[model samples]
Target chain A: MCVLAEEGYTGTADVKAFLAEHHGLALSDVDGHLYHHLNEEAIRHLFRVSSSLDSMVLGEPQILGQVKDAYGYASEFKSIGAVLDKFFSKAFSVAKRVRTETKVASSAVSISYAGVELARKIFGDLKDKTVMLIGAGEMCELAARHLLNAGVKGIMVTNRTYERAVKLAEEFDGTAIRFEEMVSHLKTADIVISSTGSPHFILKRDDVEEVIRIRRNRPMFFVDMAVPRDIDPDINDIDNVYVYDIDDLNNVIETNLEERQKEAGRAEEIVVTEVAAFRRWLDAQQVTPTIVSLRRKFDEIREAEVAKAMSMLGTDDPKTRKVVEALASSILNKVLHAPVTALKNDGNGRDPMELVAVVRELFDLTDGGKDCE
Target chain B: MQTLLLKSTTATYLVGALLYLYFIVTLKERGARLGRMFLLIGVVMHLFGFGMRFAEAGHTPITNLFESLSFFALVIVGAFLATELRYNLRVLGAFVAPLAFLFSLLSAFQKSELQSLNPALNSSWLPVHVIVLFIAYAFFAVQFAAGIMYLMQERQLKGKHLGAIFKRLPSLDVLDDINYRCLTIGFPLLTIGIITGSVWAQDAWGTYWSWDPKETASLATWLVYAALLHGRLTVGWRGRKAAIVAIVGFLLVVFTFLGINLLPAGKHTYASIAR
Candidate 1:
């Protein structure tokens, strides 16, 4: 029954540590019972749904799924209790609600998809476009998937690691080209998604310029979704080469964000409604312990009084003692009825805490005090 | 009544800006809370002001540059408030509030000449074009803020000097993601704005590709951002270099919005602040 609270931790690692340190709750502790009552409020607030913690990209929908997965893992381990279980279930519901109700989730599209969309804008139909994916990274895979889904005619994947490139190409039904042949393919590529993890530019300005010259200004869309960017910054200078680096994609991101923001407001309203509901449930929970204590106290008093009355009547007549015992039990039941009803009804109060306090005070239910004695 | 509300709201925002500055310089958590309170107050007041302006103007408070600029400032503030509420990015207030305050002050200083809508600007396309462009500009402004944070965080990481500022700022990855996200969202809006503006221009001026100074600067700004996005997505431009580019792109947006308007030779000369 130890309760501990701490200022919110910012980092994921820090949160994990905090949970472990304070609750003596390791990820391993998440048993079914614990999971059933998982500390979802803390999780939600820390993870950023309630506080919008998961929204670093501001309403991007991916993080909520990640959080759910984290909770699922915790639940699997049986570390969470009744509190955590209820909390997390509600959190999942909230996340789902937000996703459904909020424009927030809808407006902010992923950068990877933005790349493909941008390409589509330039080239009306991607069905005939040849997309060259340079550097077999995560972004490349994402962009490639989008392009393929858009019915791009062909895909050429090139990576410094030939084996990785080959694996990626195989999955996407794309051809694996050697990294050296990137510029060669660039001339033919209607759209290029460059996502290499290179420290330097993989495609130099001169190289892209040369490719553009060979292509004769037919409009090549380049999507650079890489860090330290795979394509040279200078390639934007080339005519008809519509190049969009990460920063340039802001315009698209903003429009999507605005749409998402609109959705988020709806989601937030849902969260607020859900939070109030959960609070009521919590309030009702408080009455349970009180009701249990009050019932135990009344039963003990009835038993003690009946024993004394039975002793007084038994010597004269066993039948009389039986009648007296029956009467006493009936009276006890009647006396206990109204208080129990009150306790139950008290939960419906606007401030249930006050009612709980009043009930506790009225019963003199001290933590260690025996009311019957 | 509306005019008074708007004036008071602008005053509140100015106060909020000061409080935010204090929060940044003092680096006190309480200061952050105080700053937020001020901002919230300012926003509430600004909303009142806007309502008043709408009531008095009998139109969308976006007809003249003065009203439009005021609306623009309000939109930026609204955008910031939304961002702050969602991300809990109070630190951004230090940078964003000042800009918002400056815009507000500029709006306040400008003559409130309630000119009749020009016949050319009378079309329905004007509001749509302007709204989209202004919103796009707001997003870019945020990108600029994120870029500044990115560079600072990068320097801190590289220098191994994780100070209070470093801790307060988001991680490098987060900053980069924010920058990317902002760009991705803003770019399309800008494109739409440009397209709509061109269409509107064609309706008014009988030509779409006039290459006016404002048009050219906007195109240039769009190109710069386009390049930045391409660099980040295709070329893998990120961290400090990407941040610098983002900052540079925002400057271009500023130039397109403010600087180009000041220049004498442009069809947008009427929209200029100078005259």
Candidate 2:
């Protein structure tokens, strides 16, 4: 749930114990196992996480950017090596492919979208309606943006701190009103979107009742996106007044989640295929050390054999010894060619580890292979 | 050779239209890219066809129904390509390419045997007048497509059940902006075309004012756009209302261009299929 900073570990228990010591918290032990992965499993996990398959708000786009930033920071500090480099880069690509090839992230998944959708139901078009936000909360700013994109005529912002309200209003290119004067300007808004931190209802029935009297009987929609709610629930009983809270907006978000879940199935398949491709590349890469050792062993044997034969034949002439060395290496190269090609190209998709084991036994290749370990 | 050129243009347009239609239907990004490529190719072929016809006839080639329809389709695809570049709106091509294909198809099937110009049609002003009107029709075609997309996007937004078409289409504001922009450009060109035709009529027929069906219908089209523009400026009438007017005006353009020829009375009858 929280970002781990500068924390690298080779095992799960170390991470758990570190968290417990740093934060004085303990994870429940009733579960079968706390999820953990290393190496390829870790790569697949990061790929799914970056692609938003593991996000609660399925198909949301922010997690990929966050993941990229994390990987970027880790690489900047020289903490990541070849394994993580390939894994994170491929994760970014898989995320991009899922984003473009599937309709996974097309639908907006926020409480803000629900507010805009509800306002649209009342006005049919937001092009002529005015929306007033009552707070400087993140929810208020986001809902205001959605309403603006839907073509609201104007926006009004009001906060207890007038300066903050003015700042938020400036961001939306909207007019800011003083908190005390919000009731007077309430009649100007056709859709009132409020997400304030107030403990009690900001727009009471009496205030709206008076505003309704000032204007004729035009309908007004109220979206209270705050926890503990900003608008009075009884306002729904008012004529032509609709009020929806966070839970009501959640229903809309849940429907959007279901839609994205259908698309996520295709996205997961893309991630899986990319993982398999990356695995093949990694397996081929693993064969490189054994190939290097095999060539080293063959060269050493050729040099030793040529020296022994030159003295045994009593041939000190450089031309005669040169012919012998060339003849010896040609047979070695021809023997190495087929096995090298099989390992490099992976033509039949044979198990690369088994092939490596065979080469190790056949040629007694061990020097450069041990260097790799 | 000219007939073959026209046929080839039609074939290219057919491919372009199918690609664009499939792009819209499937929301395929590659289809849009390839569709744009084919549409531009079709435009190039159409321009070559027009150039050949002009060379063959020794004049601007829109003297009859067959030639005029081909010219109209050419200007439409040409103007459509220019707008697509300006806006970077591939979806607009999806809505307009089919009209180009249909017109090109009709042009190919029509009697393409070149006719000696009826003496009444020999005025130099006739070519300029027809070309300007068709260019105006080209912008109107853009307006029609933009309006349809505006309504469709608006419906999708309001209905709250967006599908592939909604996602492929542009924003409602962009679509509305395109509609208004096309109207502003099309209306004045149409007015000038109408004025030029009246002058040509006066010189040829000895009268500047004739309430013939083509004249009347074009006048009606002009008035609709003019009123819409005026409302946009003075009363701020736009969006769905402006889109509807633009659509209605496009219908009037279609009618004045060809439907009036279907009627019994008009001096323009010899310029059409009845001859």
Which window of ten consecutive residues has the lowest lDDT sum in model 1 chain A?
A1-10
lDDT string, candidate 1, A31-97, tens digits? 3223211343644363245325346766655666666676677779865545445566777777766
Residue-level lDDT of model 2, residues A237-348, one tens digit each, is 6655667777767765676777788998899899888777776655544678778877888899999999999999997999998899889989999998998888776424
Instruction: Quote the lDDT for B92 in model 2.
Output: 88
Write candidate 2's Cα lDDT for B112-155 as tens digits. 87778788878899877888889989999988998998778766
Backbone clashes under 3 angstroms, per model: 83, 0
Docking class of 2: incorrect
Evaluate model 2 with DockQ and give the value: 0.14
Candidate 2 Cα misplacement greater than 4 A, ranges: A1-33, A38-40, A69-79, A113-131, A135-138, A141-155, A159-175, A178-255, A284-373
lDDT, candidate 2, at B215? 83
What candidate 1 gets wrong by more than 4 Å, as runs, is A1-373, B25-28
DockQ of 1: 0.02
